[model samples]
Target: MHRGRLFRPTVFIIISCILFLQGLSAAPPLQTGSFIRDAEIEATLHEYITPLFRVAKLDPKSLNLYVIVNPEINASASIRYSIFINTGLLLESKTPEQVIGVLAHETGHIAGGHISRTEGAMGKATLAAMAAMALGTAAAIASNSSDAAMASILGGMSMAQGIVFHYSRGQEGTADSSGVHYLDDLKWSSRGLLEFMQMLEKQEYLSPDQQDVYMRTHPFSRDRVDFLKQHLKNSPYANNRLPQDFYEKYDRMIAKLSAYLEPPGKTLLTYRATDQSVKARYARAIAFYRENNFPEASKQLDGLIHEFPRDPYFHEIKGQFMFEQGRLDDALTSYKQAIEIKPDAPLIHLAYAQTLIEKNQPKMDKEAIHELRNVLKDEEENSFAWRLLAIAYGRGGNLGMSSLALAEEALANDKPKIALTQSKRSQYHLKSGPDKLRAADIQSLAERLVKEKE
Candidate 1:
């Protein structure tokens, strides 16, 4: 079966190593761990956060949200309005409100300019400490040496403590107040924030090293919860309820994440026959798919499509299953339907293009090139799409375009030397036009990067 380089862990690891060696001259790309990308989940999160952003007087469109695959219950805000949320938090949250509450708190950090202020104070020292901690964490996982890991982390923290503006308790209080104000403005309850804080309260007894990353970064206090409680008691929207569909979407997001991340056997055991809800069935379908139970997987997916006929994501999942199972024609059909339902989703377009390239028919290759170019119009940074575009161009006998696409892919993947070579090669084949000018630009960038490395 032709694999279209989806979530290639090795590539990510290599990119991470390259970035580490290069040093943080610019903000290192967001390489925190495996990232989970799905159009539906992203849309849901956008819906959840847009109102909060508006309430906070921030532009919703400017914020970038990333769903990390880690199972830790943590969220962080970084430069450029980037917010990272862990899948574990979504799976563990009891209600949509709870997840929103966490997001609100993180948004509080963004609106209050906490991340930038902290970074300014710590400067390069903070980056160095983070690198040391990352190395220590990797060593701990590789060698199972908790003592060594703890020593490294504590050493890094200690070294940076003098310069780091470790958010004062007063800052935490301000964030809490800001979050509550956003919730109130949106006519949503602050109960979720209170409940989440109370849950973290149980971790107070644990040693600093034993605490989750959230508690480590956020620095919880009873007074923070009490302060929230006091405001919640007087807030006009204390008892408001989220929409019913909100719960359904939230449940499905959790189920999907659990199915994809957990062991197939474990997922199947957790979502049993008795629980016939849509989300449960979806999880079972994915678990069965992963286990290679093709018949059962198709059966569950068909049932979902039958029930929610217009849900584009269900169709997308079915397409993914068919593609993995080597049913190219059927997969193409399913992907087409999904795109028809949600034509604007770049991810769906990428998937469809990938399947088309894997099919490898000359006509399909041409179509895949068209689709990929369209995708690049909106998602220019997508290296996988660029890689597939290269494949498509090569298959269609467009050597110049193929070389240019390869250069773009290498650049996106941070292989400046490879990009430089490809860009130079493309210049030999490409005619004088916009494409050649673009190739020249890439060649210049690649040369600059190589010089920096030297």
Candidate 2:
């Protein structure tokens, strides 16, 4: 989705709205933090959890999933109906079922209402603390590159570590049971969950610092392992096999992550040229690109495109490689191909819009603006898209709309002062209209938020 390697983490924060609107229909304050945003990976996650959510009688749309950029093997559910899964957990998982097991467990917590009961007493304090940290994270994101923002963002994560949803031992046991039950109801094996717990059991004797973040937060026990063991023995679906397509997708996901997250040299070594499997070729292509061996990367990617023309990800990654190398025309062609295959992916749309904007053709600015608006319709809080939209409007010679777009960008990035200034500027430059009226609303909201923070 970004200009970075495919499946790699891009640092960005979604900060809280400081004040909740007063009304019966007032929505809960959105949580704040840094995380990866990849359309392909997110779609895969949603696919894995859909049935789990359905079996648990929870609405999939009501729950949000975030892939935290941390390397700790952890997944946590917040009382606000969000699940945060660390990148380490995704990469470390050997099978889709293992990851599904974890999601099922988290869904158990959500369905059992464990999060609120455990976190209710500390809700206000946790919310206030995370909101305070949001300003620093947002500032770091605004001022730094992805790599530079890692430390500050992780520091922000550490500030709220182990406090958000520290479930009790009893709750953990209940979640285990519920998780396996959901898997069983779907006729999927819970063996993965049992295997995962057994792996955690070995860490029980390790010192606190030596244990994984999940162990520290989830409070693993031998009893939990035993519960899973006994359940597997009794459950009829314990040995059920997942679809072949699941493994294929899971393997590709892992290969893509390794190629992006691991060192280029390491990925090349792991997936050598002698290996011609789809996963190997995918990894090697990314590794070659990362190593700046464009010829080899091109060969691999071109082969992939020929072999699997319908696979949008291959085209998407090829587009990213071209986009990074400043081949706007080539990138645009690849991105358009990807979009044709997968029309609803917002990240791909964001990249396509970015490519159009970078072309700097006056005629193309309108097309860029159209793509950006569609992206915003899907992801209204995407500050990066808003920033691009501002640039597109500026290039189109629309100063008032450009200023209004900057106001929206600043608002999404939690820069109240900038939003206040830009909104006022937009109001002055534009004639009375819906957009000008929207600027007035932003100015009012920004004014209130600024005053409250002070």
Candidate 3:
């Protein structure tokens, strides 16, 4: 259950000993990436759990929910009330109703104050609460804003204090009841929940890492299913429930992403030379692209575009293929088509703008900057867009704005290409108008950061 990393959550002290024996780092980078395009799962959880919250006499409106793209099978209430689901669990779960069950259980953890009890009263502990300190909280903390809240969190500082786990038998029973009630309200079957619990209980017999991802953090047992079954048998709903759509979109996402995990040669072999199968053809296209078979990849994309016709993702892939071939104009056109179909998708706009910058066309400079600015609004931290925006501004003769954008890039990464661009632009504008000032600004910004880090 713990292989995905960071395993010492008070109840997981046993798992930690297993981790130590296995020679794995106790911590891994806290991930913030995930399947952001389709948020159906998170939104569904929010909708289904609302009734359960009311039944349990808790305010559902105040809690924030987030779907984080983590490979581990665990959910946690962050420092605040944000309920986070690892994308891995969503992709791996065999049934949609089972996911809803997981959501209900996590919500129970929240209402029961698992995170808050561990991390004393802070502000409105939102997933964004850490970042909110820089940008004021949308709502301040209610009762736990006092200093005593701080003491409680400090006491549970190590997260291994047996005192921190508040999920007693009573809370667990209540959570099961609320989960079944929520399922009944939605008219969806609750059998998936019990089945999932059974799987985790089986994992308890295996090695720690061999444990089902949920049990490491969720902690399961035989009693959980007994309680769930008791509720199921006692209810009139035992014979009544709605059919759930188990063909979850996340599964499709995983399938598409798996196109990357396959070996370049093996994936290519999976594709038929003919073009009937889009999925296989896509794997072939990816294989070729990774292998630097740009011309072949482009040809494959053309065939895919004709077959799928309306899939914007293929167009975006075509744009990438062209971009790598240095066919800037063609790449720009491909990306523009993708943007037309999915206008709100920032990656398409960013890709288009990046190609335009690479093209270094004077006429495209303004359009490139405009597109990048729009992308930044939705993705303030997209380092790639910042780099391209700097190029666009520099090409447009707006050296100051270019330098600011470059500064953002420098803040993101110290890629030599960006550094070289800044250096050259600074040289060209030395002691001149805004260019000189912009150059000086960039030099100061980059140098200051490097010095501070030193």
Candidate 4:
């Protein structure tokens, strides 16, 4: 319930957002939608769901959570222990409890083995690819809500791919029942799920074309409502409310997303000038930045930083703003401050490393390489980090290490042939050492993968 952590921008990975996409063995790369990574949002979600996963006897570590940058009110669980949630659902939720409720339902799907029962028209690899395609790269840019919804939800594996990420009424009912039990066990209210269901009930009357993606996929029923209503009536924890502090955190999360993902004008309108709340000001600051009103944006951010100097996210965003504006020195200072506050955040380190690499100063290359290596420790398959590491190594005049990094990057990005070539180049340049051994290993793996393609 601690609301100390906050979101920072600039950790978007075309690959990391789809956590499983990088490890695909023989499958072709699928076009991915925009997925984002925010340390605070992901951490908050992890906090909310850890209990549910525990209650369900699911390994929290094995389960991956992804936030797709789409404005569709949908969430889905993959057969491979991954959960995908859209930004629209996060923004649409009235409270963190509502989000938790939905997540519990998804957890139910994972716990109940419903995902495996669903037809695998797409093989496990394809299914993983599809689930991953749901979120990746940047915010989804599809202009048409319907198309975007289907693409984001199904990862473009809709009817065209002969795949429907739907569940039967019975499965949904089981998930609802399981979700209710999980919440009840934790002494939390079931009202969040009930209210979310009731909210979707209205969409049932609409045509399939007009209905929200959740309705089309989840198959809502009055029986679901009646069952939840009955459970709430009898459960002792039925009236439980989330901590008041959580609501503020939830609002800040939503505000950050809206400021970054929504139209600048729309975000500004929603978080009006008169509303002096932290969340409101945060939204306005990002909106002003998006509008290119740097002065006003800096004013808002500076005020927030003055008030909350220790907040790493404030510094993180200030760094992002500065980096994007080509103010490398100012950006470096802010990013360094953010890292000083939250040293363990890999994404922030990744951003800082990227800025260091971009500054193009040889003296900083060593720092950039070190930071990139730290990022890879946490995110080994992060192709972006590998790519940045390659740049850092190249800048430091370590061609052998640079080639090895590029090979790693290529492997992560599913370009095994390129990996093979780069690994060979790396071996040619390096003497016998752990780095050379790594290059040899990459060569063998890449060669095998390339052969698998043939």
Best by TM-score: 2
Reference-based lDDT, residue 124, model 2: 43
- Candidate 2 per-residue C-alpha lDDT over 1-454 given as tens digits, one digit per residue, 9 for 90 to 100: 2221111111223432211001001111122233555667778888889899999999887666777545778898875457888778888777888999999999999999886433343644343324332222122225533333334333445444434457889989999989998998899999888888877888899999999878977989888988888989998998898877888888887887677767778998999889999999998988887777889989999999999999998899888788767787999999999999999988888778877877779888899899988987766656667777778888777989999988987776567799999999999989999999989988988887688668
**lDDT tens string, model 3, 1-454?**
1122111122111100000000001112122332222222333466656765675566776555555445656665643345656666765677656676777776666666655343432311211222111100000112213233222222222221112123555566666666777677656567767876776776778887777555655556678889888877776666554343333333334434334444566556655576446566666676677676767766777887998677677787777666656677888888888888778666577667766766667978788888988977755534456666766776777775676676555433333245446655655645566646655655655565455435
lDDT of prediction 2: 0.74
TM-score of 1: 0.82
Query: All candidates' lDDT scores?
Result: 0.73, 0.74, 0.54, 0.74
> Where is model 3 poorest over a 10-residue stretch in terms of lDDT?
15-24
| Model 3, runs deviating above 4 Å | 1-72, 75-113, 116-195, 227-248, 265-281, 291-303, 406-454
lDDT ranking, high to low:
4, 2, 1, 3
Model 2 alpha-carbon drift over 4 Å, by segment:
1-34, 116-164
**What clash pairs does model 4 have?**
35-136
Q: How far is 388's C-alpha from truth in model 1 (Å)?
A: 0.7
lDDT of 1 by residue, 1-454 (tens): 1112222222121111111111111111223343446777887898899999999999887776767655667877765576778777887788899999988988898899886444344345333323222222223323445455334333433342232224556677788889988998889999999988988899999998787677877778999989988988998899999878888889888888777777778889999978999999999998887777889988998999999889999999888777656687998999999999999888788888878877769999999989988988766656666777887888788888999998977776556799899999889899999988888988988888788658
Per-residue lDDT of model 4, residues 1-454, tens digit only? 1111111011111234332211111112222234556776776788889999999999887667878655668888875577888788998988788899999999999999887432344443343433243322111212323334334434543322232467889999999999999998889999999989999988888988888789977889999999999999999998888767668778888898777766778988999999989999999998888778989999999999999999998899888788767787999999899999999888788778877877778988899888988887776666667777777787777899999988877766556799899999999999999999989988888887787768
TM-score per candidate? 0.82, 0.84, 0.57, 0.84
